[model samples]
Target: MSAFPLALPDDAELSARLSARIGQHWHRLLAALRPLYGEGAWEGELAARLLGAAIARPADLRALDQVREAAPDWFQKPEMVGYCTYIDRFGGTLAGTRARLDELSQLGVRYFHPLPLLKPREGDSDGGFAVADFRQVDPKLGSIDDLRALASDLRARGISLCLDIVCNHTADTHDWALAAKAGDAKYRDFYHVVEAADQVAAYEAHLGQVFPQTAPGNFTFVPEMQGHVWTTFYPFQWDLNYANPVVFIEMMDVLLYLANQGAEVFRLDSAPFLWKRAGSDCRGLPETHQVVRAWRAALAIVAPAVALKAEAIVGLAEVLPFLGEPEQPECHLAYNNTAMTALWAALATGDTRPLSTCLTQALAKPAGAGWLTYVRCHDDIIWGALKGVIPDETLARISDFYAGAVPGSFADGQAFQAEPGAVRSTNGMAASLAGVRDGADNAAALARLRLLYGVTFALDGIPAIYMGDERALTNDPDYAVEPDHDDGRWLHRPRMDWTRNGGPTHAAIARFAQLRQGRACLHAGNPARPLLTADPALLAFERADRGGDRLICLGWFKGDAMTTDLSGLLGSGDWIDLLDGTDVNAQSVAMAPWGLRWLVKKNG
Candidate 1:
C-alpha cells in the first residue's frame, strides 16, 4: 500500500501496484493542499506517511476491496436499501446489534449507518457528534472490539457498515485540545487561535451563528489558552486549523484507521466547514472542497473499498460541490437533505410544487455517485435549503402548521428555537409530523404514515429508514427528562421497540422493500422525472430504466378524499397498480384520505 512496507505482501504484483498508486495520487493530493499549506509545508511528507500507514491495512479488508472493485455499482442497485440509527437506541449495544442481523437482513437492508458512536465529552455531547477521542468508541455504546465484531457480523450478512467521522471540530476535551491547554505550542496550533477580540470580530462579520439560541457565535474564549478560538457549532467543540498541514494529516489517518476497523463507508461530517478564512462566509469554501478532494485521493491509494459520504446540509447549489466535478470526484455518496425537507413540505401543504422544483433543479449526481434519501433523519428539519424553491408565505404556513402553531394541525412538533424573528426550524418524529399520533384518527394516521413513507421508498435513490421510522414511531414526550434533554432533536431519536408496535409499520416497510427490490427501474441510478400531473394534492414521480421498466408513484397527502383526472399523465398503454392488483386507467382515480398508488408496467 506504500512505497516502503515493513514487509511486502507475498503477492508481488499487488504490492508493486499499491506502491505505484502512492506516487500516482501524491501529485493530485499535493496540488490540492499547496494552496492552504503552501509549497514549503510538509504536506507531501505527510501524504507519504499516510501511504505508509496503508501498508498496515488488514488483509481481510484488502480482500473486501477486490470484491467491491469488481462490482463498484453494488450500492446503486434497487436492493441497496439503507437504515440509520444510533448503536444504543437501535440495539442496546454492539453485541445486541449482532443478535439482530437476521432481522435486518429480512428487511432487505444492505447499508446500515449507525449514528456517531465515537467517544465524546462527558455530558451533552450533541448526540455523540462531539468527539473527544478519534479512535475510541463511547463506553456507553461498547468497546472498539465490540464495534469491530459487529462490523464483521454485518459484513458476513451482506451489509455495509457506515460510520460517522466528525471532520469539522473536536470536543474541547480531545487530546489535541487538552494539549493546547497544557501549554504545548505545536498542539495549540492545531486549533484556530485569535489573541485579540477584533480578530474574532473579523471572522464573525461574515459567519452566521450555527446554534443561535445556544452557542450564538463563531468564537469562544478559552481562558486556559488565553485566546479566543473559533467554534462554529458549540463552545465546547473547537474548530481545527486546517491551515496547518499536521491537522490534515492526523484527520486523514484517523479516517483510514476507522476504515481498517471494518467501516465500509465514512460519513464526513460538516464537510463544508473544514477550512475557514477571515471576511468570508466560512462555509463551502474552495479550500474545503480541495481538502475533501485530497482526502478522497488519499483514500483511493489506501482503502479503495471504502467510500466517503458527505454530510454537508447546505443549499442545493453549494452541496453539489462536495460531490466534486465529474473529472475529480470527492465523495461517493451524499445526503439529499434538500429532498428530505421538500418531501415534508409537500406532505404538509399537499402541494408538489416545492418538491418538484427541488427535483427539477439539482437531483442529478456524478456518474458513480448517488444520494442517501430519507424521509427523516436524526436532526431538525431546516428550511433554509429550499428558501427560493418554496414561496416565503407558503413556507410560513407550512412551517407554522408543522410546528403546531395552526389550529387543528395534527403535527405535534417542537421548534428547535422559538426566537421571535428568526427562521424557525422544526423537529419531531416523521410520523407525528405527518399527522400520525395519539387521540387522532388511528386509521388516518396510519394511512398518512404509509403514504409519506411510500413516497420515500418510491423515489429514485437509496431509500433510508430512520431506525424507528418504519415502526411509525412518534415523538418521544419523555425525552425532555433525559440527561442530554435540552436538544429538541432527541424527540425523534427514540429507542426502537423491537416489538415494532405489532408490526403495522413493519409490514408496510417489508412490503415496500419487496416491491422495490430486484427492479432495475427502482435503482438509484435510474432516471427519475417529476411528472406534472397538475394535481395539487398528489406528489407524483416517474422512475424508468433503460430496459423500459417504469414506475409511477403517487402519494395523496391532502387528508381528504380526492377524485382527480390522471389521464394527461398516461398514454394508451395499460398500467397496473403494484400496491393492490388493480388496473390503472386514464379516467379519474379515487384515493382515500392518505393513500399511495404505485402504477407500474402492465406485466411488472
Candidate 2:
C-alpha cells in the first residue's frame, strides 16, 4: 500500500536532493525501523513518505537545515537559553506572541516552547495535550497561518520555536479516533481496543495509574467500539497503537507537516509510553527507544534543522535511553527531571547529597545531546523521579514540606494527586515554592528564588525560565475556581501580568544570563562535576571546558549564614566571584543565607 499519494518530484533538482538524502540516511532509517516492520511493503511506503516530505519542505527551511548541519553544536552552546510558556498565557494570540519575542530575546532566550497549542478536545483537554488534530493550530490561540508568521518572526529574532508533539495518545474526538468509534476496522487498528476482559486485566496488572484520584484506570470502556480502549493518563485520551505500521507512518507525516510549518523543535510529550508489551510495565520499553530512534532518523533525513526533545520524566536509569548512545543518537535534548526533582528535595531537606548523586549521573549523556534544565515547569514536581536516590519516607517529608504541611514551612504550594500516607507531587509557581509571598519574609523568598535560578543557569545544559517566574509570581490563589481547570498544575500556569515590571528576582536572572553567555566553560558539552562539600546545606559543582576555562558554582540553601573553605576544591588559585565583582580567598569563603556564587579563576 502506498503511504503517501504523491509520486516522485518532476523537478530534477528536487529529485536529486531527495535521492541523495535517502542514500545518506537509508541505512540508519532502516536499521531503526526494520525491528518493528521487518522486510516488506512497509519499507517502500515509508520511503515514499520520506521523499514526499523532503520534496514538500520549504526552500528557506532547507537553507536553515544546511546552516544547522554546518553547526551541529548550535543548541549546545553556552548562550543557548530557553523560555517556556503557553500561547494563551504569554500572548493572547499567535500574532500577540510575535510582539513578545523582543522580551524573550532580552532574557537571553534562544529557544521558546509555547506549551501545546494544537487543536484539542472541546473540554478538559489535558492542558491542550489531548490533541485532536496534528496539523491545525487551535482556533482560540490562532490560525495555522498565524503560527507560520509567528515562527518567521521568532526566527528573525534568533529564536527557535518549539511545539509539543503528543506522541503517546490522541483525544478521543480525533479524526482517527472518531473513525474507530464509527466501526472502521482499519482506523480502529490505530488504537489499542481490547474486547476481552482477561486482556484488559492482564495489561492493568502491570500498569500504574497516572491520576488515581480522577481517572483511576488504564482502560476506558467505549461502548461505540464495543471494547475498552487504552488510556494511560485520562479516559478521553486514547493511546495510539504503535504496533501497527500505519500509526508510525501517520505520525511521521504529522512531524514532517509541522516541520514544514516552521516548528524548529518538537517536545515529544509522553515519550516513554509510546510502546506497550503485555505482562510488563509499559513504560520506557526497548521498543519505545527504537521508535524514537526511527523518528530521529526520519527528521534527520527530511528536516535536519528540527530537533527532537524527549519529555520522558521517569527515573534516571529509564530516562537515559531516550537520549540514545552516540552511535545511534535519539533525542537532541531531554529534560533533566531527576536533577530538577533533586533540587527541590535538597531545598526541603537542606541536604545536597541526593542532588549531588543525581548530578553525578546526569553528567554523562550522548555526545550531541543536551539536558533541558529549569527551576520550575508547567507541571507538577513529581517526586517519583527521585525514588532510587532518596528514600520514600524522606520524599514524603519533602512533599509535605512543600505543601506547607510541615511546621514553619517556608513554601506555600499545593499537593497534586496525593494519596494519604504516600509521597505526593507538588504544584506551584517557582516563586511560591521558593517561599515568595506578601509578608516580611518576602526578601528572603526573593533571594531563595534567585539562588535556584542561579544554580539552574550555571548547570551544564540549556537553562529554561518558566513564564512569570522572573517577576517572582506567586501561586494563583483562584486557579481552582475556573471551569475545567481544577488541576493543581494550573496554580503555576497563571496568566501573565504585563503591566507589572519585574523586581530584583528579574534582575538577578538577567545578570545570570549575561554572565553565562560570556563563559565558555558553561557550555552544555562540558559536563558539570559535582563537588563534594563537608557542609550538607551547601551545594557545589564545577564546569571546566577543555580550553582551561573553569567555573565553580556554590549555593547555600540554609536560611542562616554559613562559611566554607574552597581551598580543597579551588586548589589555592586566585578566584573572583562572577555574580558580584569581589575577590575571593579560596581558604575562607563566607556565604549569606540563600547565597549563590559563580567563581571563575583570575586571569593571568
Candidate 3:
C-alpha cells in the first residue's frame, strides 16, 4: 500500500503538493469510512483511486480548489444569489444558457443551478430525476463536452455551476441496473432486492408514501430480477443499497469526476433516504450523515472548491443533521423547507406566528453551513412537512386557499397528489400563486410577489430565484396538455420568455438584489433573529453582523394598512428604510398594504 504510485504531474513540486493534501485529510476521510466499511483491503484500494482522481483533476479546477479553500465561506457571502432553471426551458441548450449569462448577471446571480440535465430514461423519467446515466448529459440538452464548456464559461463570469446528483436511487435503465437484470450477482448487490414478499411488507410498514396517488407502493416486483426491488419513489427508480461498500465507492468517484469537469456544486437529490434500516422510517439515519460526512472529507482533499447541498425536504429537526456540526461538517447547504412552508401559511392565514416560530428554530444551524432560502422552486409546496409546527387544520386551510378552493381566494393553483384528510401540496408559478390572473387586481398580485421575495432576500441565506419568477411569469396554461407532463408541478415550470422582460416584478427583484449587495448584516454568517411583534400579520427579523451593523426586515402580509411599534426592537437608533430612502420613526412604523421594509441605522 505504501508503494502505490500516484498518477500526478511530472513536476515533483506539484506531486508533493497533492500528496500533502491527501495526508492532511486522509485521517478524517478514514475516520468517516471505517464505521461504514470497517477494516478491509478495500479501504487501501479506495484511497488509491481517490488519490488518482485528485491528481487527474484539471488545472483550472485545481486553481479553483486553492481559492475556495483559502476562503471557505465564499458561498455564504451576502452577494451570493442563486438562479435555478432547466436547460431546455431556460435557453434550449447548454451553449444557449452560456450565451444568456448576461441575464443571470443582471439579476446579481452568483450561483446557477440548471435543473437536472443528466441523461434519463427515455419516457416519463420523473421530469429528469430518474437519472439513467450520471456520466453523460441528456442528448436533448447537449453532450458532456458542452456541459464542461458551459461550466467553464460560468466560472469565467464569477458564477458557480450546480448540478443535481441523485444519490438515493437510479433509473432502472441505468447500466448498473441493466447489469443486475442480466444476472450479474456482483452488480445485483448494488440495490436492495428482496426475494420474499413478507420482507417487503416489513419494510413498507415503516415507509411513508411519496406519491401515494400517482405511483403508490415502496416496492416493485420485477420478473427479470425475480424479486421485489426497493423503490421509495417510482417503480422505475430503484433505490441503492448503501450497506454495500462498493456502492459508496462508486458514487464518491462520480462526484470527483463531475468536479473535475468544472462543476462547483452537487445537489444531492433525495439525500435523506440514502441509508435504509429495517423496521425504521429509513430517513435521515445516522449512516446517511456518515456517508455525507465522508463525501465532504473526500471533497476537501480532492476538490475543496466543490460543495454539497442536501435536498432534504423533511421537517426542521430532520433537516438539521444534513447540515452537520462544525466539527464534522456534512453538506455546505440544505433547503429551508420549514421557513418556505411557513411563509406560505402566513400569507394565507394572515398570521405570522407560524413563520416566526419556524424562523426562530432555523436560527440555529452549523457555523460552516447555510440555508438555501427561496420563494418558489420546481417542486410543489408540500404542506405535510409542517405537521407539528403548524396545526393540522391550519395546514389544510392554507393548502385549500393556495389550491384556489377557498372562497374569494386570488390564487389559481392546483393541488398535487392530494389524498383525502391529508395535508395537501399545492403547485403553481409564483405569479399565479401571488394572484396574478385575467381578472384579478394585478397591483395587489405584484405586491404579494414583491413581499414574498423581499422576505427571502432579507433572510440569512443564499436566496434562490426559480426560473421565470423574476418576470412574474404565470402558470403554464398548457402544462397538462404537454406529453408525459400530467404532473401538476409542471404548472410552475414554464419556459423563460426572454422577449417579455423589465416588468414591475422584475424591477422589484433587481431592487432587492441591489439592496442585498455589499451588506455584511445580510451575510449568511449572521443568522436572522426573528422578532415578536404585536400584530400577527407583520413578520419581523433582525440581522446584525459582528461589526455592529444591524438590519431589521419587516414584511406585512395583510392587504390593509397597518402600523407596529418598533421602538422596543430598534432602540436608540435613527433608522432609514433601505427599500425607499424614507426615515422610519422607531416609535411608530407605518406599513402600506402588502408592504416590505429593510431598516438600517441612519448614517451609521
TM-scores of all models?
0.95, 0.97, 0.97
Evaluation by TM-score, superior candidate among 1 and 2: 2
Residue ranges of candidate 3 with Cα displaced over 4 Å: 1-10, 418-421, 438-440
Query: What's the lDDT of the predicted structure labeled candidate 1?
Result: 0.82
Structure candidate 3, residue pairs in collision: none
Task: Tell me the deviation in Å of residue 445 in model 1.
Answer: 1.5
Predictions in order: lDDT: 0.82, 0.88, 0.89
lDDT of model number 3: 0.89
lDDT, candidate 1, 1-604, per-residue tens: 2233234456686677576766677677777877787776475467556656667788888888877768877778888888999888888888888887776887788899999999999988888989999899999888999989989999888889999999999999999999999999999999999999987887788888778888788888999999998898989999999888888989998988898899999999988898888889889889999999998888877888888899988678887788887667788888888888888887777787778777776556775787888888898888777888887677777778888998878787877763335467889988888777665566777787788778888876678988777777888889979897778789898888876563577788878888887887988777467888777777788888889889988888787898887878876677788888798776767777888998986876
Off by over 4 Å in 1: 1-13, 40-44, 418-420, 500-502
**C-alpha lDDT (0 to 100) for residue 432 of candidate 3:** 94
The pairs that clash in candidate 2 are none
List runs of model 2 lying over 4 Å from the truth: 1-17, 418-422, 439-441
- Residue-pair clashes, model 3: 0
